[model samples]
Target chain A: MQKNKLIAGVSAGGLALLSSPAFAQSIDETVNHLFASATGWFVNFIFSPFPGTSFPWIVAWLVVAATVFTFYFTFIQFRAFKHSISLVKGDYSDPNDAGEVSHFQALATALSGTVGLGNIAGVAVAVGIGGPGATFWMILAGLMGMASKFTECTLGVKYRNEYADGTVSGGPMYYLTKGFAERGLPGGRFLAILFSIFCILGALGGGNMFQANQAHQQISGILGDFPGWITGVVFALVVFAVIVGGLKSIAKVTEKVVPFMGVMYVGAAIIILLVNADQIGWAFGQIFAGAFTGLGVAGGMVGALIQGFKRAAFSNEAGVGSAAIAHSAVRTKEPITEGFVSLLEPFIDTVVICTMTALVIIITGQLSIDPATGNYLTEGGRIVTVTGASGVGLTSAAFESAFSWFPYVLAIAVILFAFSTMISWSYYGLKAWTYLFGEGKTTEVVFKVIFCIFVVIGAAANLGPVIDFSDAAIFAMAVVNITGLYCLMPIVKRELTSYLARLESGEIKKFK
Target chain B: MATKYIVACDGSSASGRAIKVAVEQAKLNGASLLLVHVLEWSPYSFLTPEELEERHKRRNEELKRAQLALVDPLVESLSSEGVESSAIIRYGHVSETIADIAEKEGAAQIFVGRTGQSTLTKLIFGSVAASLAQIAPVPCTIVP
Candidate 1:
């Protein structure tokens, strides 16, 4: 009887395995179809172009808000640039202050969140599509983004709630609700709720899923083609450990290691540039020429500008109000100091780092620009990706051309970047979750489990419409955040003026 | 004017000897003893935003616990022995902070327990006694 049972179990297992492939394929198709249809309306509405134009209204919304803040603050990004450096260096920090974080710690954590795929893959996408000129617009947008970061972060700290248990919470949600009410403005609560909802969606899609998706792609590129679900399950388990198990040491280790990888990445870029030293001037020339003439890039200069601003906004996230959540945790009596520290984020992320990625791609001949036509080589009316690979893969190809061993390094960096991003976004999403549902152990755990599950789904499925919807959700945050920022600008100006006046009078003591 | 002496405590047997020597010296010289316990910390160490958020609260808790467990009882025992004493707790590089307190307090001399760190540790991260001997503004005494 036992021998008969064993034989029967083995036969059943074999039979199920033989049939499972077709069943699995059908399931995958059904899920993909459902996601595409469900998310189509949101993606269309958010990314819909302006009247008779291809420019996305969401991109325009972010750019306009950044530009307005730059003017409203009297170019505070430039004016307080020196002060921002001082604050980050801890020269003005009071060790006895009630806050938890130093300016540098806050900036570094926020940078880890914003600096991931956007700097690596997103820049590749921009330059690949918009030509070399997108670099120029990207740098410009990054600079203007400083002011927007400064305003939102200042408001974040000013409106943060401190509890008797020695814990605190702050972000765009706090500012929108409390700040609006303080100014006697109606609809602050509604706006806050809307912002929180979008923030959660953005966190799931772009932060968790997109990160897992890209990481799996990079790993499979190296380790040989296997199912994405395998990668997804592994990533999900590790992420679950860090976020749910409270494995803070692992999180801290990643935080330290990610910055080191960032440095190595930049160093490699510098070496590649130096290796092709003679082409440095020509690369800049291409950037400048492409910015205006579009270098035969489709949709001309306007296309370049749109891609540049969109990628930079996506990369630095200056106006999205996410950085405000990170910066609000800083320990300081003066809220304006965090704002100063935050402006450096865009400058470093987009102007410095993203520019490096663009130059490497342009200089290494990955773009394959045709000198005769003054246009990048194209197939089927669209600029072709190297080896039919786009995004981080294209970036890897560019680096591989310089160093044969670089793909392995690139793969490691990509995984590290993806992991760091997921952890940071987990925190951001958790904050949004608690804001909406009210802080509770069970409620928090529910959000985390859902976030981890999405990581697996994000890795397994190729959900184009879903990813688009997620991107739109991130920008939707900018819409609600920037509106609150407009009403709250005067408040930021008041804080900045007072802080600067005190600094000039030597009233703010220098600790070092 | 009464002189002042500094004692570094680590709640070790070596530190007990150091404390006894300092108390004796304080009585003889009519000096007040400032017992200092320094917790090792590096400002350059990076932390996550969540960790950073809880840092100040954690630091305060650590300081409170150190004062109650290490510094206060020692100070009370010294006073009972008719030795004038006070206590301080701080976070930073161990030797450097103790030396800093010595300089700022205008003490004539400093006393410390020879650290019990192993040879490998001492070679890697030098013992506090060795560091204090080199950098202290006042003469440093390391009691075994």
Candidate 2:
């Protein structure tokens, strides 16, 4: 509720850096000289052509696609929301179906892909830039994004190819090529190739590297700075083990870990919020008030919306189509049921987890605001940006406010999140690689080994260009995926209609 | 036959003992032994068409492998010792499948292993031995 909650009460670690002028100044100068110019231009280029604003049009592209899908599906995300939950609970799944995993396992695996460091760091970054008001828009984006997830994942299952060996491969590449061919479309092959390339890049960069980097940041903050290579090497090794074991192992771990970690994270957040119960109402007021008026942010309402939309896109990755890969593994004869299952992903990842992170940051009062123009003071530097350390550190600080040793807990959670994301992405990238390279033991191992190597590079390298490339690669995937979605949406719609009819007729029995 | 006995084997020592017991029972009753092994297979029930086909294919392979590795060897050993024996392998829930085979074969009794799961593990995931004992259409014995 206080206006000047910033510049003061940084967590113990944050406070130490902020209080020491010599250390902070030197680090700031070095970081600025090293990365600011490079990142600034790269960011501007990616986000350029937003007409009146420098806002990343890719964010707008994602939001608009979500909105369109929501309207096109006649709010399927809303109407089928209950069915979606039940589908994830495996009510309609027929064990006789031809897939490797259950509906719930597929949902959990996809969720692990979507609910990574993005839920942790991405939310704090949104709130850091957009203030508390961003939470509203973030939830909005998540809700709409569900429909896009539905469309893509349905296509994923419908068009997935099963090798003679019993393993299945899916995602946008399968759908774009196979679906388009069914429709006699011209660009199916071309689009499929394009999507595969981007997906591979995205898998390595955002999926593996960025996760490693953020996990490194969180761990180093708690454990004291060790060489980033150590975190990378360990992550690389663990990721290798799970991935080399095969999709079943990844599915097994994700189904258990994602739910447990989600509960633990949200449980901790709920406890913290309950402890600060007095500020609960006040925090909502701030979120609402800041959302429309921009809370005196630099770009006003536009900035808040941009940050919320951008971070939500980055977090849940609804239209980005990576989730389709994970979801396609579901053992459902009805592909649409997996679609129903996937729609819950963004809801859980962004609407639930991301919002929790934001609320924690807001309620714990970690954001540093300027009293003059009511503008939040964001200190930009090398790796750790923002004056009070926004992103995961801000989230960490918020939790640290409640318990002195909570940073350690946050570190463990981050590593787990990072680990799960990497494993899921390994599957995604492998599918994409095999799409281009053809499926075999050798090709799959090649993709996996490359993925693990990037984990090390991501942890060890300075983040600036790596994050830029990762972000660009991810956006590149979204570009290709959304294009294919627009082309194949009619088929998705038909599937949706038939599924609803079957559901109503009780053709799809509820085994649960 | 004077009497027929079904012995379920899972390549475990308890099941081996059960096989021995079934042999002894068949010998005493001047009957025959139906040596059977059920591979535990429960589909998640959500596979795509291709995966489902593969699962069914794998199920057949598993049944064949079990018959070769488990039931065939046990049946051969029994025949060598002058216990009239036949072998079959199936894939399904362990207890139910065993019951089904015994019913279909018109066996007079059933013998099963009592190992593979501790009480706590059994509580978490249903114990096949306990379930078989409860649901067996014929007289059932659990050999430890």
Candidate 3:
């Protein structure tokens, strides 16, 4: 259904561009118009601030959800941290178990979904606009967000549809509908449908377009300027090959390559931090002070808090419920185990990796600050002052200050990050698509083709609308998911209570 | 008393030779044959969520295929030779699972074909025969 809306918008742009004699000159405008107009109302609605405040209600929605879940579960993210690690280590796993995937595999699959441009580009945006203090808020939100993951993922597994054929299907759609009906609650099906719609949009906007747009931005930083559509078309074809052509071996190769790239990216960040070891203390100081006082950055402490929480939610996706889809596939009788495993995602993506990126930007002196006023030099492009370098470009500049060839390496990483993210999101969106439209080859192909088209459109469209819609769609998911979670969280808490009791009584023994 | 002999099959000619040898031993001793086939699998693997979702289905399919192609024919042939036989198919590390089955079944001895893997392959991945020799509870014979 959403695909039809997208097709109408795209064909409108196609018609406009085809009618124009200068196709190259008008393509950007037309694509931007189509994307912005189609998604603008939804974006404005999702991000519309609470009352008169500058803070987007969507950001507050996620923040409040995470905070509440943290308390409601009595800080399960912290309590289960050690146990979660053990579960991931396979301590309780039996060799003769009939499960399909290990806890580690489930966590890794979900991590690859969450940790992408949000760590690199999104961090740079946070620090560039919100100052170093955003780093502190980002970490705080990441920690709290872990609880949200625990609740949602637990419900995801408990309510998932396990078929006799040994395949399982789950996510917000399944849990919201099934759990609601089981509880005799109204609107479960409605909310489930609504969540699926937002999920599909989120998958396309944040998962597909935002990634392609950023990948193009980084590639263009080194490769000189060209029409983004060319890059978009190339990306779309490669993605089409994997998702539609049934070349799962390519997906397998990417599954291997992406983790290696993630490690290399983190290794580079660590090396940069070590080299700038002396400034680490000062950078932390900036982060702490800016978090409270805003360090004369725009919008003061409130701006920092908003950007920190917003980007953290976007980065880790703790409350948005997408990770629950991936986590539900684990081979475990205890639904709580996957929940425990999932809490590590926000910590890794936000607290650890996002902080590394923020520290690099701050330590590498990317944000131009005036010594006398102790304010960001906002006169002439002070934030990310390396002349038009923002997002991945800003991150690339920071890393390049440490290594001359880093940009070249970064371009490769960004593209791989983008491609892998696109592939993962395709599956996510397909799940949502199948939920709404019913699962069939044709329905599946229809969604896949629309997803590929958006890849091109995302790459070609301007960043402003693409990011706005991406943030909106993702947050929209949080609204429905968290509302459903509030009703169903007690169920998760019961499961956790029972599981822990069993563990303490030695009813559940560790095999290793 | 009737005894038991275990033969590991991979459908290769080497395994066919091992089956023949195990059959001869089983018939001479009035023993039954237990034909085992272990499909190599590890809990540790990097998979996409979609692949993970379908993994159980694929595992079932592979198990069924191995049962049909590797174990059933051998079980029928052993029966025709006047040796009682049964088959078990599983998924795990080949040598380890074979050793485990041997221990569990209390077999007198075990038989496996010498794999045609290259020296470097054997060095890198470890030969199944070499692993069985180290881990099997009973005496193990490798049919070349």
Candidate 4:
């Protein structure tokens, strides 16, 4: 007990010292020095071949890759948006269909998993660091992302397994194995196993820990120094309850919750934009200027574009194939129906919701730079900002400046969004886990328990490096997933042509 | 005194035709007709208990009035032809209520129309129909 008290006393003293103006300034200086050194190292690595080569250049390369993919797929994302809406509405239900849930429910479940922090925090980070111009590139990246979603989800349904009892299992694992096996590849199973492992890791990190940490931060920020352990415990309990009930339960909850939370949050942002009415034009000007002129942030035009594209890619997760796992369980025989619905993900996420966040941040003028040093400042101290989480707080503050009670509303929305996301992602990770490990009830339950525990850990721990790592893990998964989609494009084209033929022939009628 | 059959009518033209077919089949088999129409629980499930009860009662009356309108015409026609028929109004999910009424009425068969008010095509053969088909105690037919 004496030792514990002494440690506590020492920590409090350290904190007090850290909070002093002199100490804080010194800390800032130290951080700047460290950042400079790190930036130098990164610059050297990136520019080894040429002095001007940088990380943003690599990001530009990724954007080109995504853009090329979008074109190669014949701009299917734009052409299929309306059809995607109809698909979700289940306008073409066949009696002999062989799946578990409606297309809308599948999209809802998948959206619930993908639409969380990415829309709220991810957008903010893109606009915050990348400048307003990032929004333009982000939207473009999201458009390309749609084709990726279409390819992956179609493959998810096409390669799904129907068990003896009529339950279904699918996703990248199934396609990598079954699709590749059909091509007479000797190592199809091995590749599938590897994909599943990556998916599980990606799910656990990006899907579970990242979500929980942000949720915990938001709750703790509102509640004011509430023990991290308490937040973790509550989050774990709620997550355990829903996930234990399995995918159907998760789907049911997400179907209801995703729509409600989405409308509420988006509606709030719309209200803010309306209130700011006249400044809307100026905000757009800043975004476009910051995007092209590269006058705002340190990274220049290329840096800004990369930040925007990276954030959007991270947000919608179109190419990742994780969302396809959720969509695969949808009850329908037509793989194309779910694929169509899956395309709406990036639209709602990056285009609509992310745009709203960018508007709020930009219109409020809270993200403006200091004229003397060209550094950004908020609340009068050198802005101690991490990308996603800090961006969400900036948005909340903007709303609070406009409407006094909006902070509370934003907090509630964040919790609901985060909670729904965590639950849906638990299913995604578990499927991947089951695909690689043995599929037993016990195995699933154990995974749920571990996932829930991470919620607490994520909520409590310092997550700056952790979330970065998690985001990287998710991007890595996208690399593999998009590769598979590229290779399997021919199959998607075949399915699309066949389905469109049937539609044209009137063999499938619209819902009466 | 052959086995009775329950046929549900929802007041649509298709439902009317379905009832006619069901009654003709029942008459041919020497079975009685027990026509039923179910009034669903309200969409506003988040209301207060008193409000809910009032809503439920009002819905019940509406259903009763509709059922009587359907049954009177059929009864008059049947009685003139020296045939027997009866009708009922119940409150619940359409499929579940139909299954329950069938068991209680000792029905040997059940009949339904193909579509309902909700334009959701997927749901027509979805959970409700799937459940009834799997667990209904009698054979069921859906007339398009």
- Which candidate ranks first by DockQ, i.e. highest? 3
Error of 2 at A509 (Å): 2.5
lDDT values for all models: 0.85, 0.77, 0.87, 0.68
Question: Candidate 4 on A349-444: residue-level lDDT in tens?
Answer: 888888898888878776766779654443322133422236567777777777888878777777777777776667677777888787899998
Higher-lDDT candidate of 2 and 4: 2
Return the lDDT, model 2, position A365.
78
Give candidate 4 regions above 4 Å deviation: A1-52, A56-65, A95-100, A245-255, A370-389, B1-6, B9-144
In model 3, which runs have C-alpha deviations exceeding 4 angstroms? A1-23, A379-382, A386-388, B1-6, B23-33, B82-85, B100-110, B133-140
Model 1, A347-407: lDDT tens digits are 9999999999999988887876677986877665346755666778889899999999998
Chain A TM per candidate, in order of listing: 0.94, 0.87, 0.96, 0.84
Q: Residue A120: error of model 3 in Å?
A: 1.5
User: Each candidate's DockQ score against the native complex?
Assistant: 0.51, 0.16, 0.54, 0.05
**Candidate 1 chain B: worst-modelled 10 consecutive residues by lDDT:** B40-49
Residues B1-144, candidate 4, lDDT per residue (tens digit)? 567877777677867777778878877888777777766542212221112113324444565577567667776776676557788776556777789878877898887766544657655546444566766889987676
Give candidate 1's error at residue A165 in angstroms. 0.7
Model 2: share of real contacts kept: 0.03
User: Which candidate has the top score in lDDT?
Assistant: 3
Please give the TM-score that candidate 1 achieves against the real structure.
0.94
Model 1 per-residue lDDT at A456: 70
